[model samples]
Target: MDAQQVFALLCIGFVLAAFDKKKEHFPLPLLLLAAGILCSFVPFFSNIEVTRDLIFDWFLPALLFVAAYQFPYRDLKKDAGLISTLATIGLLLTFILLGISLYILLSPFLEVSLVACLLIAAMLTPTDPVSVVTILKQTGPQEAADIVEGESLLNDGTSIVLFTLMSTMYFESQQFSINSFLIDFLLVTFSGAAIGLIIAFLANKWMHLIKDNEYHIFLSLLLAYISFYIAESLQVSGILATVAAGLFLSRHFHVNGDKEVKERLDGFWGIIELLMICLVFLLIGIAGGQQPYISYLYYILAGFLLMIAARYIVLALIMYLIPFWRHRFHFQDYLILGWGGMKGTISLALLLGLNAGGKNSEVIFTLTFGIVFLSIFIQSLTMYPITRKLKAQEQKKKESS
Candidate 1:
């Protein structure tokens, strides 16, 4: 297919997703993923694959920029401690334990190395901000949603940095040491933020100088791609850079601009966010279409259990040990937190990005796909009910008090 054809289909995908969003029964991500899966079998489009470059280079920056801009920084600041703990410590523990436990549990049967297990863990660790924002709006307390979303926003950078670290260790045959890991983690995190801040600062200045609202809106589009590229070029976490730059630029742009610029910026990014979501889910479905699900049933089931159990254990420990968390968050809210760590497009992108080491690669990749599908489909189905129960309990407590 020519470049033009691909763009045309993406346009169509956006329209389809827009229409589907109105239907309460089918959430937009699931709907598009399903559509992509069904479309995979069709004779016309089966040959064309959505390249990893297309997704990474284009789709992701747009998604990340808009999400950061829309995020309530004030709310995030208040819950910084909990979010930081979950995003850093909580994520690291789950990623390590998930890999180690899976390696132990599936030991003799699955011929995967410890390093490979760690890589798998890192890939699945980051909660999807895209999914976080979309689902949390309908359920739970504002604080709970803020913590989860903030953790997701920050933790994605952590997870990706960890993923790169693990990948390097495995590929380069380097020994993993705590001191080395700590130094590298700090380097990646700080570098990403610095890069973002600098770019966003300059971008803001450029926008203020421009009097045209249209140019300011379009400049945001460039800001996303530029920040991501510059960060990646410097060998740091592009995702984090994009997040930081977005938070700053959005605030700066809104403060300096007239009403028209703010509205235009919001509208343009809004369309891009929707389109990115649609295309990502669709690509997930298409990528997953060729897998032998029946043959890989055991891996899928086991992987799902391992991921869920790891999350449950982390939540339990965090709530039990932290007095503030224990007192502030209801047990039901804790349950929601455990189940709410849904994986999406980023997981798949990482899996595809890594060097495949023969047959075992397929197993790990398929296991990841299973986690993502279950996260979006099975877990999402129960979310509304869980939130309803939590809200009801919250209301009752208010009445009783």
Candidate 2:
């Protein structure tokens, strides 16, 4: 489809979704996924192709920046311990457990290697911030939501590091060295963070000099692209840099001078987000349709089981280590946390970026997409119910006291 047609369809979808009060029943992503699938059935629409350059260069940076800019820095700081644990140690545990579980499950049927399994696990490790934060704003507790957002932000960087390392190992047939891995991971993360900090500091210092609202808004948008580009050029994590810049700008730049400008910027970005959401889900559905469903039926089922088992095991381990978590967050809270870690566009993008000639590339991509689809549809839809129940239980306890 041409850009105009794509934008038109996206606008229609956004309007329908925005006006519909029953958003809980048919979330935006699910709706977009359905629309994409339905559209693909048409002859003309079937030819629509989503390019990696569009996603990596245009959409991702914008999405990351918006998420980062809107995120409350002070609230994130307050729950630093919980967020840190979940994003870092929690992510590592999830990757290891999930990787092992998938390896064991797929070992008998397919000659799935450990490295390939790890790559898949790493790809799905980071939860999509856009979906989670949007949902959390409505259903989760204030403190819990902040922690969730913070964890999501940091986990994206961590997951990319793990995914990049595992992808290299799989394609290059390289042996794993702890020292080398740690050094690479640390360097990527630190460099991304540093770039973000520098951009934020400079933006803050100069933002006061700009009096025009339109110009200020433009600067914010430009800053997002600059951060991502600079980070990528430096061989650091562009995702991390975009996020850091967003957070920095949000905290430092005030929208007080012109309400109209602020509103216009918000509206413009809101449109961008909706279009991106539709494009992403559309790509996901198209990718899903390309796979032979019957061939991977058993593998998909096994993957589902493995993911759940891994999540529970990891949660149990984390809870055991930090007894305070058990007291602070109940069983339902843990369950929601595990389930809410739904994989989305980032995972799909990474899968597509994998070398097609690499061994097990097709199988890995198909299974990854299937696993991610199930995670988003089943887990994301049910997360709010679980969280609501947990919140009710907490409220009851407080009332009794």
Per-prediction CA RMSD (Å): 2.3, 2.5
lDDT of 2 at 270: 75
Pairs with steric clashes in candidate 2: none
lDDT tens digits by residue: candidate 2, 1-401: 58775775667577757775866555677667666666666666666766556667877888878888777667666677878788888889889988988898888889789999999999877777877755655666566566667878877778878988898999998899889888888888879978987987787667678777777778878888998899999999888898888877666535333456557667767766766776767666765666765688788878977887777687778776787777877666666666666677777777777787999877897888788878777766776677777878888999999
Indicate which candidate wins on lDDT. Answer: 1
Compared with the true structure, all predictions reach lDDT values of: 0.79, 0.76
Worst 10 residues of 2 by lDDT: 252-261
The runs of at least 3 residues in candidate 1 whose Cα sits more than 4 Å from the true structure, single-residue gaps closed, are 1-8, 11-15, 21-25, 171-173, 253-259, 357-359, 396-401
| Model 1 clashing residue pairs (backbone) | none
Residue 282 in model 1: shift from native, Å?
0.6
Alpha-carbon error at 249 in model 2, in Å?
2.0
Please report how far candidate 2 places residue 73 from its true position, in Å. 1.3
